[model samples]
Target: MRPKMEFDPLAFFTPSLKEDSVFIQDDSLSVKAHVQIAIHQSVTSERVTSWHDDSCDECEEEEDALMPLHILDLPMLRLQPPYPVLVTILKLLSPDEVLNFEPSNRQQNANPDEEAIFREKAISSIHLKNALTWLNNSCPRLNASAKLSLVPHLSLALRANFTNEYNAYMTRIVSNELSWMSEAEKEEVQSLASMRISENCGRMAQPQLKRKIHLANLEKYGREYIYLNEPSMTNDNLGLKTWGSSLILGSRLLRVSTGSPFLKEPVLELGSGTGLVGMCCCLMGMVTTLTDLPQIVPNLQTNLKLNNLENYSCAELDWSAPGSSPVYGKSFSTVVVSDPVYSSQHPHWVVNMISLFLNDDINNNSVLIEVPLRPSFENERQLLWKLMSDQFVEVESEIEDGYDDFGEMKFCYKRFIRKI
Candidate 1:
């Protein structure tokens, strides 16, 4: 028979996380310690020593405290997108049975029998209130149409006593980013305001140009990312949206056959759209700088904070204005580029930027670039290959498939070491 487990007070309870460090909390006593649970293995011993040094007697009865414990990584707490989750949540909150939000087949895949239980849980006043608060604060950079469409559903949810919160959020939206929305868009919103709330409840499709997509690298690093993307029509710069090559490049960079070069070097990523690849480098314990055009810098910065990765930084670097001086200083050991070759002129501009920013210590430094194969940029692709190969030898090359802004496109990644 297996030995019965005993309740151990010093069994390493979950320490409260404040930023990067961890702390212990009791009813009347709160102690902050430098011992990080995730990074350190001997947390209990360290905690005992730390508490003793700090003169705490809560667990002093036990001299040698030991417990079979594993400090597990915390699961990421992410906001569910407002479309389906919020829509169903709102329907559950409304007292009036005007709208019937039957679960879609995809939603039923989780557990068909627990629909009532899920609905009851969703209707909890606290959950509903918290959901609204999160939506107001952490809402993605959505376009006017998407924002306007949610008004009806939001109205139904706020029908009880939460109108003030809804009104405040709407006012802020209108006065802030939506202020410059076209006159037609304002009229469209006004028209929708009077429409039946039930009909619009099910019309929750995200527009093509302004979809919020999440890309995951959980296998490489332990986290996934959320990115707000605008199609080429909405934003002139394609860097506003994430491309498939960034994923390919990110995975390739993390799963390199050689030693983890990223861990040893200061890395710079050019054309870092949504900063997915660069952020992955940071997750792998490298100091990564994500750079793009000035317009895309703010959004990239927002993404960094959204993912709780403010340790990584962002900068503005236009390849067209490739300057003589190193933009991010002169010490970047690895330079990464994802889908940077688009137009014919891009090859020269991008290569020049790489040459300027990438370190000259050929033996120790390298350039990692992933370029998609597009028929329109065939000549430009050849030019980029020629220019990079002349100055840098291809230490590692991978011809892989990835999606571009338009969808799946074949891509090739090359790790280049400057020729001796």
Candidate 2:
């Protein structure tokens, strides 16, 4: 007799377990009919089981092939755009997987100019209404410094390409909020204003052309008695080119004069344009007085402030006119001027002015003048030199390099030491 098989419900339903033979629930009286029928069914069932096993084997092979793809062993997804897409992929990646995502050259070559133009247009159109909305909506979370950055960009847009609608808006914002700003914020606003003006002008933009002309005039007249003031305050091409040479020679003379143990006297700089030479004297510990026309006094003051020197004072003194005595009247140890002989009519007048201001004490008094050796002013320079020689026993002259905007020129310095 064949061994009896127990029925298993799970094995009967499962496709994998139907491979060998069919099992009967009861041993029937007729093995020919029931048992034969079961055997026939079992034979057919085994064929179906073999087909399912083959199908499962094919499926397992396909899944195994796709496993490497799920791990992203290839570089398909990385070659994409929109930074957020890359960020998302990066977040999904492990540290080692992230190392494989190299930046694509093609993606990097995408044009940003369109984006920039759009941003500029949008920022330019940000009017008062929008700015106020932005402030109301965003400012509570931002610090004062961050809030300050918004105004300057808006100011630039207003001054550059924006319509009056924007300017009026900016003006309102500034007028209302600027006073409440900290000192640093106020400075930032001032800087923005200056930057806007500079950007619009494309150069060092002066507020007034007339003021510039007046300042230039001061430089020209003041250059006669102050050596360093020539190139600094005046825009004269000749004066700037001759400056370097004058500085070298002037420096030598300054050393000789100041080296004297008994020469503890104040220096006076006439026509002290930007006050460069006079400032040099101050640096050497000499109290120096700077003078120019009335119109240039404010500019001179500004220059002095820029240099952070406290020992110098500016006054308006026309070399042609007799004036109130200066602070060190008749007591100035040194009187200095640079490029003062540019005009023919003014040479003699400058000489007379020098004569009047020189200390009567006579022992330690000296006048130093630096003039460019331009052909046009040669006669005037000679006349002034002669006048100085006549007034002082010791008159000396030297030639030095001069600085001009175009290049360099030879300049002359005439020194007159009064005889006791």
Of candidate 1, the 10-residue stretch with the lowest lDDT total is 67-76
Per-residue accuracy of model 1 over 1-420 as CA lDDT, tens digit each: 212223222221223232223332221222222333222211211121133334656644422221111111101123323333243333332322211121122112211233353343244444444544555555432112223222222222222123334334333333432343356644443333222232222122112232333344444555543344332323244566666778787766666532465334678889998787887777776778888877778878877776676446788777776452236455678888887876557788888877778778755688888877765567778999899977778888878876532334578888887778
- lDDT (0 to 1) per candidate: 0.51, 0.42
Backbone clash pairs for candidate 1 read: none
lDDT of 2 by residue, 160-268 (tens): 2232332343233334334444667455444443333332331122122111111112232332223122122232222221233335444554555454633344777
Counting clashing residue pairs in each candidate, in order, gives 0, 18
TM-score of each: 0.52, 0.43
Candidate 1, residue 384: how far the Cα is off, in Å: 0.6
